[model samples]
Every structure is written in structure tokens, then in C-alpha cells.
Target: MILETFKHFPDFELLDSGNGYRLERWGAYRLARPDPQAIWEHQLADAEWKKADAIFNSKWQVKTSVSQPWPIRFPLPLKAGEAKTGEWSIKLLARLSTFKHTGIFAEQAANWEWLTEQVQNTEFKAQKEQLKILNLFGYTGAATILLAKLGCFVTHVDASKPAITWAKENQIANNLPNDSIRWILDDAAKFVKRELKRGAKYDGILMDPPAFGHAPSGRTWKFAEDFPRLLADCTELLSTNAKFLLVNAYATNSSAIALQNLLEDSIKKTGTLESGELCLKQNSGRLISTGIFGRWSK
Candidate 1:
């Protein structure tokens, strides 16, 4: 299992947590957000609360048009049907109003760093082709941007138009290579199946499948029921010298060991395996176990 001991934007501190809320400072904005896992009491200076630029309330919108009743100062990067409007900037929008999710998951920072490292550390000069990466369930393309920044050719796949647009924005925001990623709007499993039939292959694969979701074609997906088969199918799409395969899961009772075992069982005929939980450190000096991650490599 790979352990993430460091991270980007140490500038953002999760200063405290309590009563289903967290106090955090992202850049200059001190804000409060709901964290169901944060069941403890809040213990921070009163000054922190007073300095917040915004507090994301329970109300949100998921539409082609975004209208905020409050004075919305912060940028919302991932919305339902928003188009990419700016270059080198984070664009946020709400696609689902059930929670405060803007469609981008912050816990993915660890996976982004991991994929970038794999791309950079590979022996590219000795290889016959450029490193090719496939980011399945690639919402907003954060991982796509990181891999592209590391000089990998990435195929970013997602079923949402807004997500693909936001990912394009992030790529521009980081000034990444324009042609580095091939964006696709499709169901991940079906796409992989087609890629295999076409004899396509990739050096690195990153997936953060939702617990449950539907495609543009109205196809339903349940991770627990579909993941094992998906992993098995993905094995056929890996290059003979593939570097890594990463699977990330959240809000599921599935344990890290369970993810590890599944990957091991599915890919044992092909490569080596490593798997575990990915976590973040909150400001209260506590670890927030965010999700399960599994990896396989030649």
C-alpha cells in the first residue's frame, strides 16, 4: 500500500473540526463547510469565524444557468451544464443540490500527486512511445491536468459536459499542453470495452468511480456490483509495461482491504498490486480517512 505523507497547498489549513462542520483556510478565505464525519466540538478562535469570505450553505443549484441569491464571491468550478468561460482560472458550479458538492472532490489531490510521480519517474527515453494515461470517471480533470503537466498523453473521460469543460479550464489554468488530453463524454465502462476492442492501451490508469451513477444513455452503475468486472476488463487495456492502475472510492463501507483484495484477485494474472485508504490531515491534528485506493503495476 502506498502512503501519502505530504501534499500540495499546505497553504490551506483544516484548522479545526466539530459538530459536523470544519473550519478551514484556503488561501485567504476562512470558511465553514459541513463534514458529517466531524462529530466533535469546534475549538477555534472567534476571529477565524468572523474572517470567513463565505460559508457554503445547504442550498445549491444544478443547471445550465446559475443564479445565486446571496452575494457569491467565490468561484464554483464544477456545475451541471456550465461552459468553460475563462482561461487559467478555476470555474465552479453546482450540478447537484442534495449537498454542498461542487462535483470536484478535494481528496483527489493525493491521487493527482501519485499519478504525476508515476509519469515523471518512468523511463520515457527508453520506451518506444510516449506515456499514455486514461483518467476514467475523470471529473473536472484535476488528475488529467497533473498527468498532462508531467508530459503524459491523457484521455479524460466523463459523462458530464460541465465536468469536461471545467477540466479544460483547469488545464488552461495550469497552462498545460493544449493537446495533452483527449476529452470524452461517455460511460467509463463502455468506453474501456471499446478501447480494448480497438486494441488501445495505456501506461497509467486513474479511476474515481462514484458509488452510484447514470450515463447519458440512462445506464445505471452500482460500484459494488460493477467494479470487479470493470477491473477485470481494464486489465486488457493496460500496456505490457504499464506503470500503474489506481482505483478510488468514497462514502462506501468498502474497506481499503476490500479494494485491495478485489484488485489483486482481478489482476493477479497480469501484474503486482498495492492498495489502501487515502486520507487527509485536518487542522485539529486528526486524520480524515477520505477514501479507499487500490493500485496495480507491472
Candidate 2:
């Protein structure tokens, strides 16, 4: 029952959450977005909620006069030279969308931090083996960028062309090397299958699958029906010296324990499996569960 919470992101903050919505700050812009999990009463005063620069109403309508595509910065994995302690920037479009998302999932900071530590471990560095990572369903490339910054060769896959484009834009905004990541616009399951057929292997794998989605080719993906098959195929793509496998699910009926069980049963490898809810800590000290995730590490 490990609950992973992300509270150290300087550029992001959960100011308040309640009544099926969350108030958050991304850089200097404040936004209010829908969150069914924020069912409790809000602690912040009305005036505080009113200070939002924009609010997403039902039907994905945004009510505000805020500017579009604002920039936000976050600390990157430590690197060499004066830029070692420097931060990375990304552009955010605070507009209402079909998914009611604002490009970034702040709750994933916990996973990003964990992935970075895993890559930077002394043992990993001592081995002098360059790690290759595959990121499936990598929307906007947050984790992809972080992994690439750690010197890992990354292959990022997504089903939406727009998502891949936006992710590339983020890469450029962060000033990452043009060749830092290989972008693939295809269905996650199909892409994994093709990689398996090609005998391609990766040192690490990360997937964040939606409950229900449509592939670029119009193929439908239902989590309950496709996740098991996808996991089986993905296990075959893991190198013998694999370092980690991470899976995240949002708005799904499955529990963290279920995710852990599935990974244990499908991976066919001995390792440590941990699962829990990914949460965001509000200023009121309350944790708003955003999703469930499971990770396996050697």
C-alpha cells in the first residue's frame, strides 16, 4: 500500500480540490480542471478559487481570458557543467480539450524522480552499458525527456500524431538534442508486437494506457481486453538485463494490487513489484488520488 505523492515540483502546485474539480498552478498560471476523485469539500476560500486564470467547465469549455501557450520550467536530472543544476522548460496550452487535460500530469513527478534515480544509480553507471528505454503511450514526452536527459536512448510511441508533434515541441523547448528520442506514432500494442517481431530489446519499459482509446488507424483499445495481451508481448521485448518496468492506468476499475499481480504473472522474471495510487498533495495537506501504478525493478 505504498502511496506515491509528488510535492517537490516547484513549478506545479495543487492549491485546492473539491466538488469534482481541482485548482492548480502551473508556473504563474492558475487553472481549475475537473477531477471526479476530488469529491470532498474544498478548504480554500471562494476568493482563492476565483483567482484561477482559467477554468474548464463541462463539455470541455474553458471560461477565461488567459493567454494561450504559457511557458513553465522544472528542474531536470543533474547534468554536467554550469547547466548541471539548470532547469528545463515546456510550453503549456491551458485550453479546454476533449480529455480535459493540460498537457502535463504533475502526479507523475513521483515516477519521474524514481526513474531518474534508477538511471543514475552508481551500479548502473559503473556498468558503462548504455541503457535503451521504450516509452509506450508516451503523451507529450515528459518521462521520455527526463529519461533521455539521463543519457538513456529512448524510443517514444504514441497513437496520436498531434501528441507526437507536441512531444517533439517540448523536446525542442527544453533544448534537448535532436536525436535524444525516436518518436513513433502508432498504437502501443501494435508497436510492441512489431518490436518483438524485429527482435528488438530494451533495458527499461514504461507504459501509461488509457481506459479506452482509438489507434491512429482506427483500431480500438479497451484496457480490460487489451492490457493482458499487451503486457505479454512487452515482456518479450525486455532485455535479459532489464532494469525496470512501469505501468500506469487512469480512470480504470482495476486496483493497484491487480496491476501488481498482472505484472508478476506476465513478466516471468524475479524482481520486486510495488504498486499504489499516484496522488497530488493539496495545500490543505489532503492527497487527491490521480491514478494507480505498478512498477517492477531488479
Candidate 3:
């Protein structure tokens, strides 16, 4: 809560943007993808844009046959340990999908970092056991792997089977213990309700819900209608000392203020509440706002 409102994934870069597209460098590959935020004129030359390894116009266009999966590693703060040279890190498997995603949301890198910081600070010396964290709408598990690496036991819930499988691969990629993460392939709201019924509680909870989607069981999740109900359910599921709760949204009508208000209204606990836009800083020192986020922590 004491850092910049805008942050980005150090491993990724937004190279240029314009014409409803953004050119990005993910690890070593350059990609051009459609972005609603790129409403201005092109900042880079066409020649420069021609170097993209892949360009998406409803699909990928590349010069050569592309690999299936690649690694994008984020260095972690070195833990208290014996080795000096070896640093802790986690890697997300990157792949070009039909939906034009590389299996990770680059903008969420900040929230992942912030969540870790909040948990670390809140845990203090009082809590010794591994914290139980719930990750709803857990996509490819970037935060899941990162947090689990810090020794948290995470329950990752998502409706998509493919997403859960990819997240499992990411877990293995990090070499985390098998019991570190509980992979649950179920609708997020339904799963949360079940957890509430089971009297389950979490030390922390984080969710990145879609603007609109359908659960695997064909239940609809409309941001305007469902988010508040989900938040109410989540409030009851948190541990009393709940170390953290993060909500990221890309809904059309949301702002940081709106997110803050929602969080403030949902939970009765007293904690630090911070909200801001999720943004990507381009090489030219410009920031492209992607989504809004609000987080609470003890």
C-alpha cells in the first residue's frame, strides 16, 4: 500500500501502440495484439512493427513455425536461506492460444507482487503456519504459483478445465510441492458458496473476474450483476485476520474509486484498502491503463 499505483511486469514490455493495437515483447518474442486502449496514432514506424514474431488479427500470423510453450521468469526476493548465489524465481509457461493470450496477464504482475508484500507484512511473527489462500477465477495461475512458492497453500478455482490443466503445468514448472496448490475446476461463485457452506475460511482471497462469461455449467457471470454477490460471499469466507483480498476487474464502467467503494462496503473488517488502475508502461515512458483493482490487507 506504500508503493506506486501504476506497475507492470518487469519481464514484459509494451513497445508501441496505435490503431487499436499494441506491440509487446514477452520474454524474447514480439507480439502485436489488439487493444481497446490504443486509440491514438501509431508511435512506431511500420518497419519497426514488421519485426513482430506474431501479429494477431483474430489469429496469429508469424514468419516461421512457432514453439508451443515458452517460459517467462520473474525473479523473487531471495528468501532467508543458506545459498547466496541462487535466487528464488517462478516461471509462467507462455503459449499462443486461439484467444490471443500467452497464458499470463502481464498487468497482474503488480498485484501479485503487492499481494505478496501485504501477506508478508501482515503475517508478522505471529503467524507461523502456511497461510491458506483462495484464488477465484484463477486463470493460468501466475499469482497462484508465485504465492505457493512463498509456501502458501492455495486453492485455485476456475470453471475451465484447460485453464486448470495449464495452471497445473505452471505449478510443475515451478517445482512446487504437490500439496502446495489445490486445483478446483468449478464455477467460482458456486465454489465459493460451497466453501461457505463447508465453513471453510481463507487467510487471503484474490479474484480477476471477466467482464462477461459463462461457467462450465452454463451459468452466466455478468460483472454488473454478479460481482457484488460474489464479494458478499467472499467477505464471509475470509479469516478474521485475513491477510489480504484483491479484486481486479475490466468491466466497462469501473474505476479505482468504484472498486474501493465495493470493497469498503462488502467487508466490515478494518484494514488498509488501496485501489488503482492496472497499467503497462511502454518503452517511451507512457502508461496504458488496462483495468482497475482494489485490495485490502491487515
Ranking by lDDT: 3, 2, 1
Q: Taking the candidates one at a time, how many backbone clashes does each contain?
A: 10, 0, 0
Q: What value does the lDDT take at residue 138 in candidate 2?
A: 96
> For each candidate, what is the lDDT?
0.70, 0.83, 0.85
Candidate that scores best on lDDT = 3
Task: List the candidate 1 regions with Cα displacement exceeding 4 Å.
Answer: 1-5, 60-98, 102-104, 126-128, 269-272
Q: TM-score of each candidate?
A: 0.82, 0.92, 0.93
Please list the residue runs of candidate 2 whose C-alpha ends up more than 4 Å from where it truly belongs after superposition. Answer: 59-65, 77-98, 122-128
Best by TM-score: 3
**How would you encode candidate 2's per-residue C-alpha lDDT over 9-116 as one tens digit per residue?**
788999999999999988777888888877888899989998887787765444556565666555655534325433453333333445667788889989988887
Report the Cα lDDT for candidate 2. 0.83
Question: In candidate 3, how many Å is residue 205 off?
Answer: 0.4
